[model samples]
Target: MAGDDEFDRWISPIEMTLNTLTNKKVRGNSIVDIPEHLKKSNMKAYKPKVVSIGPLHRKSSRELLYMKEIKWQCMLSLLHRLNPTDDQKVVPPKRLKDCGEVILKYDEAVRACYMDPIELDRHELAQIMLVDGCFLLELLLITNDKQLNGEPKSKFPVKVSKREEFLSDLKLLENQIPLFIIDLLYLKLFGQKSEGIPNIINGYALYLFGCSSGRPIISPNRAHLLELTHWFLTSRQIEAKPDQERSAPETVVELTIDPPDHEHMESMDIWLRERDERDKKVSKETTPKLERCAARLQAAGVKIKTFYGKNRSSSKLEKDPVSVMFGCKEKFEQGVLEIQSLCITEETELQWRNFIAWEQTRSAEKTWEQTGTPATEKKFSQYALLFKGLVCCEYDIELLKSAKVLKVHDENKWSNEKVNKFIHDIAEGIQIDASADPKFCEMINDLNSCDKGCCRFIMFKHCCRILLTKARKFCRYLYRLLMRDYCSTPWQTLGVMAAVLLLFLTIAQTVLAAIAL
Candidate 1:
């Protein structure tokens, strides 16, 4: 009976552990730390320089400590904005309490959004979310107001450089709090539900990012600010035709925003499955081969041209910056390869690295069943690979520049050599499934076939020209030797002729003697 009691006590802890493990709910983690391998190449790109937002980097550096005070001030300002009729100049305690309660309610969901377990206690995490979320919302409001009115009315005067740094810091993957927290707090502050929250935030993001022309598609399902920005930058706006625009009612347009999560996921799954099927069909039909460097393509009679859309207007170029097209009026002749122009600036590398890092994280989180490939198909990574294959040397850069397909904002900062290296380095460590992009695969096939068909004739002509030139040079050298040494004068010329005749007779006499023997 003593041994039985001891065994039961020991088994109790094991049973409890098993229950805890089995009962824990699995949640999708949208925000993740940059992997160490990616960080080893460029750590500065991932770390926030101005401010830290979430619990991941709350107090990692003393530099971010100053932002905490600023954040509190932002919180107060936000409360004031929410209740302007209050005569008192101080922050209302009730408003602060309401915000805290809302954040605390959603604390578990917020924690689950992060890939790694956060060490901060529940109350501490809620406080951090409340403060950071308000700070970001207030900053966006102030920036938008300033941009629209051309006057800064906020007490916390954000300088232009400081505002740029804040925007950059907010877009960092680790410096994000979930968007739902901000949305919930915005609703609490307003004391009513409004659909304008996502629009307001997304619009401000576009304005700050210098992309005001983008469509501000409101999606409550977005994970965070960085994901929203990524979607805005990558999304294309399809213009309605004249007849469709006239026939379609305005109510149909509003249906595009804030779709149900399950419907969105189902539609996405169906689209991906269809795309994978098409890719398989295309791959089986013809194997696509990557073209050689840009210079080699040019040598093969492939004309590299800048694509300005079907209308030939530069305005439409921004709609799809990474699009590539290839066509020929005749087979193996008049071949033209068109690539959208890319403008490289000082911030280009930093922005591209961060975007790629986020994509890498998202790809890592997806299941094999969802993607149907080893890596998720990312258009930006495909664009990077296109440039990586195109730019191999300074001459290729010159070719692209002359064709108006590549532009450097500042030549002094981004020289040809630097641009070439940047193009090659940006796509490193990114896994690309070439068959995922059918248009890209088709372009590669056309370029390869054009290169092979035209290069053979071009190479044959080149070799023939070289051989003819060498033969002409040999004839000229023999003529000069004979003129200088033997045919300089009449008597010398006669002596040379007699010597040639004697040599010929000696050879004939030897042949006759050998025949007689």
Candidate 2:
């Protein structure tokens, strides 16, 4: 009887969980782990380093508890910022209670953003979101201080070094809260108006972390921080219509042999079809692995420079080289390749790798939706694919360095070889489909064709010039042999002159003898 009761107790909870599965489906799906294949390269980059933001990394370590206290302080500071008045000072606890009410109102929606189930009570989950969202707002407000309406400092200044680390931490894929939730909190607290100027947090969070300038504008449809950043990096190029595939030019052979007859027509057709299929497979297999590395392209008279245009704004993110590492931009031209200056450090690997992992997952989801096949999926890791194809060897890194386009700000600890290895390793196992960016694909194709054909043309012209110069020298030597006395050695020339004089004298004697007779 006791054994039966124990089994019943276990089975009852299982049945209850099964029954609630339909309601649980609507909760959320914002957070996810790095895909299994991506973790094979470097797992550490996918994990949070200094601080944890959302529920996924909430229990990352015991040491992160202090950051929670900091979050609370941030929440308090946010309350003061929202309701600033000269008449009366607001108590922190009472202000928190009022904020807590607003958080509670949208608690279920906020909870739905996370993919994992939150075991905490509604009040606890709301408090977590409020604290984390406020923490992000406070950080962004400080970073975007120029846009602030001359508000005096209420919170102490974060150290320059600490501030950099904080920004890097916030970019982690797992440490993201939905942008809508942050906007919701902002609306509830600040009431959608910031005097006359726009609030920095609401207006520029996408711009700060995302590469917004030369790309598509931020939309409300963004899922989370990582998604926003992914869109900025690739949205414009990936979403553009795919280009048509042109077949490489082929040679035709003519023969006097008679064409196949009616009896062989069907067999001939089958053979022709098989040959075409085989040719296609071979062509795909033989497609150029790399169009040209930095060094090879430079050797072919191609120039590389830093990209600075009307689009490259001098914002705070652009001013700080460290922040730009999150989303570097570039532009490729015919003979000139211009890239945004990027300085990679030890701290940035995690942010980049996590973004890549999220992109890989999202791309898979999109492919599953569109074509129902993972193999034909388009990647959102477009920049990673470009870099992977660009840096095939050490010379490529050297070229980038000589061009002053690539920078490594690792306290000079990383050597050129080490930097080369790092960039290659980051993109080692990626499967880059050339169809993802048709413009870039065309750029690469044109470069490869030009490198091969253009170099041959230059070489042919050089060989022709050398041949012509040698021919001129040989023709001049032959003319001098016949016309000039000093054309050969002195004795040989004298001997030839003597022979000619003797022949002339003999001829004159013969003529005189004939006259005497």
Candidate 3:
């Protein structure tokens, strides 16, 4: 495939990836051993993870990367760690080599997979992992007693819990419908991505990490991210590079299951149809649409057959496969949940903790003013915007002080009639004139939203009322943009009388120089 060579190029070798699940045997100086037979096997190491599957492919797949063939020096000891049971001292009657190649299959579409490592109850764990936000695949490596070095590694910050200690069990709920999503909740909230995998998984992770820019920095598309994730899911199925080193150990894939057969699933429509006056249970009437949906699911099938141990009591507790359901609010919530997948975890917390600390410091510095005025104002971050040429070119520090005062008292909340009028007179000069460039109007409108968030935070500092007025004025100015758009009233007409002075000064300077010549 021509696309094969192209696919070969992306999928870049990032400089530092916390080693794949395969090589994780050496934890804290301990050399964990793998099983005997599998240890001598040879395999390839992965390299660029930039996959451009584009928009369509992104929406269609869960974009999981399934594991494949095992190769390592310590396959004998590593296999012991990967066993389904936690009892390392007690080896099962059957050795790992006798179990045949422990094949791994991931639902690239659903983002689900299975692992026997210390045999977790497959059905039970699967339900827990099948949650909304992120479906994680955790590969734990236990170090050999022989390799114990004295030094301890630092702990990770902000731990995200896995369902029953494994994330693959959650894959049973992968929806058939393709989705395009970028989970940025990690950067905003705890700030981190996951570990373990080929180069493809790591690349998709970097893409997710790149979206947290607060400044004028560019952000990548949510759609393409979905595509890259999908490709990573299916990565093991692809052909290996000839030049790739053979001795390099590769993470092995485990078991895979087919998509659930949901044909007999009962629907809400069937549920309502079965409703009888004799039973007459519901005190309140459900919407016709909801009743119908419930009825249909009743006629079709339910995913969960029984609640763990409790006898079912609530009528609302009827079981159904969540992946099949659809609606508007569901989509919105899904967006939120997807972002939540970005939550940093205990394993990889250090990298993101540093990121959060840097952000806070950077924000503080950016808002601080170099000019020694009020101690707070001098240190305020917005002061950076003032000098960087964002606020106003002609309006000096003094006018900005007045503008800020107005932004608070009058703008945030309703202003008294008189003071508001005075500020309107002041802002009149700042309004874009008809002769001014159209770009000026566009830029201010954009700047205007940012100023809104800025003002809200500033209110936190000063008596909230001071900044409140300026914020409100900025807001009212924003609404006026729409008004002007409709009426074609030049901004100068609004309260722009003060602008005449500014205009006069600009022209007089040119005229005076000409006269001097």
Candidate 4:
């Protein structure tokens, strides 16, 4: 018995290791609560303002508890849309029971996707999935159906005013259901294949999420709402430029991180000294601080031109409003910077925060070597880098606005200062370890080169203007004194008298000379 006990103890650990390695919970985590550090930046952004879709925020408050009836109504309406006559005669509980049974089969897989364990039992979890999935299907269907028919329908119970807020809430990181659950429910309601009809929930999500710029390849391994949306936004396959055509920007700044070799160290020191001397020679001509860049560029005779996109198709133009707002058009070229006129609204912060959180989650799982792929290009990081690179202050914002690159809706009523605050807020907590994107780096290089290239000429012209303006101001002051209108004090009155006498004597001498001739 003693020998048997020792063997059992030794084998137990191996047995547990085998079990863990073969665990059914090997699926990657999809749904996660916002990390504490990210949440600390903006607690309200992670909170559901209008409605909660998933279990994390579903029963969070009494107010949210009241939304259960609305969810039930959405489910019933979804059934009616699927099969109108039969479902109308059926009671809501009976309909829910039928849907709940279908959800139960996949409940375990769904539960594993969440980062934290759900406290609910099997039946309760199934009910949450059915209700939430139906609500989402119905909401997306309303938007898409209206777009198809070119008119709003009364089939949906949500108010038009609340739609924007609800859509915004759906985007919250904590308030999300797995896409598979939504996809399964969609297939059960609508058949697997339908001629002339779009594919299930994913199609609507792609369209409504403003992914018309390009469609991402949807794989079965998709995680959750936030993950899917990020993929759609950033993972489109763009055609690569040829290697010969993709040379680095023509700028003096070094793009490399390596130290100079010992053989070149002395030459490098000599080059630096020469460069310093050259810069000092032109220091007075190039020393004006950059104020408004566009304004400064204009002063330096650089043209600021507006560039609308190439496509004039009205059909494509009307597709996605958000995609259109992003100005995701051409690459930034020399002498012109194209920017989409995007509005900064109250919901903008919430949307951006969720995007950053999703990116951070994606970034954590990424390895250094794996980042070379198109999938791990870190598009949100690209956005932050672009904003940080272009917008240093209110002056830069004004510069973009002057060039018609950025716009705000009159309804939102955002000022230039407010927009600056909005951009900085979005950029504050996000850390992009990667360097600026190659294209963005090229753009910055061009702008900086132009800045340096024009520095001497702009400063020389600026200094001359300053001296000329001061001289003109002095001449104006002298004319005002001589004219007698400015002669209020004793010194001014005497100066005005002397100036008037001199002018009269000059005029009289001229008249006498003319008579003698």
Clash pairs, candidate 4, are: none
> Which runs of model 3 end up more than 4 angstroms from their true locations?
1-264, 267-517
- What ranking of all candidate models by lDDT puts the best one first? 1, 4, 2, 3
- For candidate 3, the lDDT comes to 0.24
For model 1 the TM-score comes to 0.66
Residue 331 displacement (Å), model 2:
4.8
Per-candidate TM-score against the hidden true structure: 0.66, 0.60, 0.18, 0.61
RMSD in Å for all candidates: 15.4, 22.7, 26.2, 17.0
lDDT (Cα, tens digit) per residue for candidate 4, span 251-272: 3221111223454545545655
Per-residue lDDT of 173 in model 4? 79
Stretches of candidate 1 exceeding 4 Å from the true structure: 1-27, 85-89, 147-152, 155-157, 194-196, 213-216, 237-289, 310-334, 363-377, 452-517
Q: Could you tell me how far off, in angstroms, the CA of residue 275 lies in candidate 4 after the best superposition?
A: 40
Residues forming the 10-long window of minimal summed lDDT in candidate 1: 323-332
lDDT top scorer = 1
Query: Cα lDDT of model 4 overall?
Result: 0.58
lDDT of each residue in 122-216, candidate 1, tens digit only: 89999889898998878777767678677744744355667656677877887888776776776677633334555555666666666563334
lDDT of 3 by residue, 1-517 (tens): 9898776533311101111111221111011111222112210001001111111112232322211111111233333444545565454334432322111111121121111121333333322222211222111111111123322121111124532112212111111111211121111112222111222223333223321111111111111222222222212223223332122234333222222123212332343354444236533321111111111111222111222113423242223212111100110111110100111122122222211111122211111122111111111111111122322212222223332211222233432433233222222211112112233333323332221113334224333444565677789998788467544656546545456678999999999999999
Please list the residue runs of candidate 4 whose C-alpha ends up more than 4 Å from where it truly belongs after superposition: 1-27, 61-66, 87-89, 92-95, 144-154, 191-198, 207-222, 235-307, 312-322, 327-330, 364-377, 411-413, 433-452, 456-517
Q: Select the stronger candidate by TM-score from 1 and 4.
A: 1
